[model samples]
Target: MKHERGLLIVLSGPSGVGKGTVRKALFECKDTTLQYSISMTTRSPREGEVNGVDYFFTTKEDFKQRIAENKFLEWAEYVGNYYGTPIEYVEKTLQEGKDILLEIEVQGALQVKKAFPEGIFIFLAPPSLKELQNRIETRGTETEDLIRNRMNAAKEELDMMDAYDYVVENDKVDSACDRVNAIITSEHLKRERVSNYYKRMLEAE
Candidate 1:
């Protein structure tokens, strides 16, 4: 059977929500193609982070210039640093009929929704606030203030979950990825391309 070309998957979650892990799992499926949008940031890349792969690190002036030119689909400042999705690359990827993934925060997700009305968004959530707090503490270097701030942010993001098309609980990697995979499959089946293909297959009857 012929399937739709690919998917535009937008994934959002707060810090320590294990979105990265789930994203990795989702990318492992053989039939699916996944690409993360490289968000430009004013913040410097940390140790071992690649220049373009992890993020497109740029200076404040360059970021501002892009903003002035309206080159970004969406942009936001966080903790004294700015981050944004470059419009040119995103449009190019979508134009190619390939799957595109954006693993961004809730704020960015909302901005994406405004630009791409048909975009599919999924929210990854921890089972509970306590589980979320515990997951954050597992890193073992958080200060009291940091922990509290992260917890508060999680609550804020969770409150906006309804805005997403699907919400998957990150209780288990396999199960979570399975749910996401199912969603992508179902969406592909819903496309008009699939119906057309089915019609062709039935012509012999």
Candidate 2:
């Protein structure tokens, strides 16, 4: 059998679009070979969140130092904290033939697109702007000012949805996850990937 390179899947969306929830549901599928790329963040861990599992929690200074060293594939500051994707881990995982999912903000996602143009970019969107506002408000995680800032950012992100390869409506978590899973499955079966496998088989024969 010919070994194939793993697919890089980038999932991005506006805040309160339920991207995190959909990602969690996607991992529940036992048949998936997908791995989650743990992002590095300078924010304090929330209740029930574990270090290295949820995020690689670090101090702002350390995170800034890493940024200066060009260690991150993509990174951005949201609200008051820094979040970034470490390039080394992601490259190593993909080399091991495991598809990895990166759930990040729009700015980071665009940065990844520039760095890895072969990646499959998926945009998770809310059913409506009104619904998105409601979801953010219901979470009660941020103050009014922060929520307003996020909403403005969301509007700008939505305008860039055309740049993504796929757009999944996150009205229902299960349904959104289903769509994302289908996309990954289909990407694996793309003509280019299958053609490479066939070529390798012919070469060996």
Candidate 3:
């Protein structure tokens, strides 16, 4: 039997929305066949961040060259650092019938939507703006000025939540992961997917 193409699950939100935390929990809580797409960046690696695992670290020139060659599914520059998702790996993974999760920001997610409209877009949101600020401050990773800037960006990103197929509130990591898992399961059972499966079965028979 021929397997159907895997789902492209795009999980995106503003900074400090706990998208990463929820994604990690989803992986741990489910035995689903999924792969996490590792993004490429021109920024220097942080402490304890492995080269290939955390990000595919590259030089500014190399990253720009790839962008010129249209290698990225989506690319963006934030805080003077270039970050992008390489298209090759993601396409190969989908063709192999393994779902892939892309944990990205709002802008990149929109870009992906244009390139691959079939992908499932899920927006992770904070319970409230105040809670979002608290989460950002709690991280202690950014300066006051940077935090403020992120908050501004978050506001703009939150406004785009309607564009996503599903909006998941990240009030609690476990609950958020549960919602995400449910969405993925539901997407797999979508009419289009089921119809393809049914057609394949009839052909085989």
Candidate 4:
């Protein structure tokens, strides 16, 4: 039987909407089987962050060279650093019939949509804009000006929710993970995805 290409699950939303927190929790779950597409970044690694596991750390020159080569599926610059998804690894993984998850920023996610419309896009939204601001404020690492800027960016990002196939509220990490897992399972079961498998089985019979 021919193998089916795996699903590209993109999870994104406003900056402080907890995309990373939820993604980490989801992957830790025993039932989660999606392979995470490690992102490439020009930023220095944080404490306890492994080179390849956390992110593919690289220099600005190397990252820019790849961009010129058009090797990124989606790339974005933020806070004076570059972050991008490599097209090679993602394509190879999907061709092997193993689902891959991409936790990215909204702008990068939109770019991915243009390249792979069949990919599942999930928007992780905050309960409310006010709550989103609170989350950013809670971090306490950003200066007041940066917080204001992030709030402005969040508003614009939230407006793009219509582009996503699903909108999941990040009210609680565990609850959000449940919703994300359920969405993945449901997508796999869609007739359009599994119909060919059933047809092949019938033909074999």
The digit string of per-residue lDDT tens for model 4 on 1-205 reads 2338999999999888998789889889987778999999998885677888879999999999999999999999966789899999999999999999998888899999999999999999999999999988887777898888888888888899899999999999999999999999899888889889989899999
lDDT of 1 by residue, 106-152 (tens): 88889999988678899998988898899889867677888898788
Ranked by lDDT, top first: 2, 4, 3, 1
Tens-digit lDDT track for model 2 on 1-205? 3346788999999999988789888888898778999999998887787998878999999999999999999999987899999999999999988899999989899999999999999999999999999999998778899899999999999999998999999989989989999998898888887887788779999
Residues forming the 10-long window of minimal summed lDDT in candidate 4:
1-10
- Collision pairs in model 1: none
Flag the better candidate by lDDT, 1 or 3: 3
Clashes of each: 0, 0, 0, 0
Candidate 2 accuracy as lDDT: 0.91
Question: Could you estimate the TM-score for every candidate?
Answer: 0.84, 0.96, 0.93, 0.93
lDDT of 3 by residue, 1-205 (tens): 2356888999999989987788777777557677999899888785677888868999999999999999999998875788899999999999998899999878899999999999999999999999999998997778899899989999999999888999999999988888999998888877877787788779999
Candidates' RMSD to native: 2.9, 1.2, 1.7, 1.8
The better candidate by lDDT, 1 or 4, is: 4
The runs of at least 3 residues in candidate 3 whose Cα sits more than 4 Å from the true structure, single-residue gaps closed, are: 46-48
Q: Provide the lowest-lDDT 10-residue window in model 3.
A: 24-33
Give all candidates' CA lDDT scores. 0.82, 0.91, 0.89, 0.91
RMSD of 4: 1.8
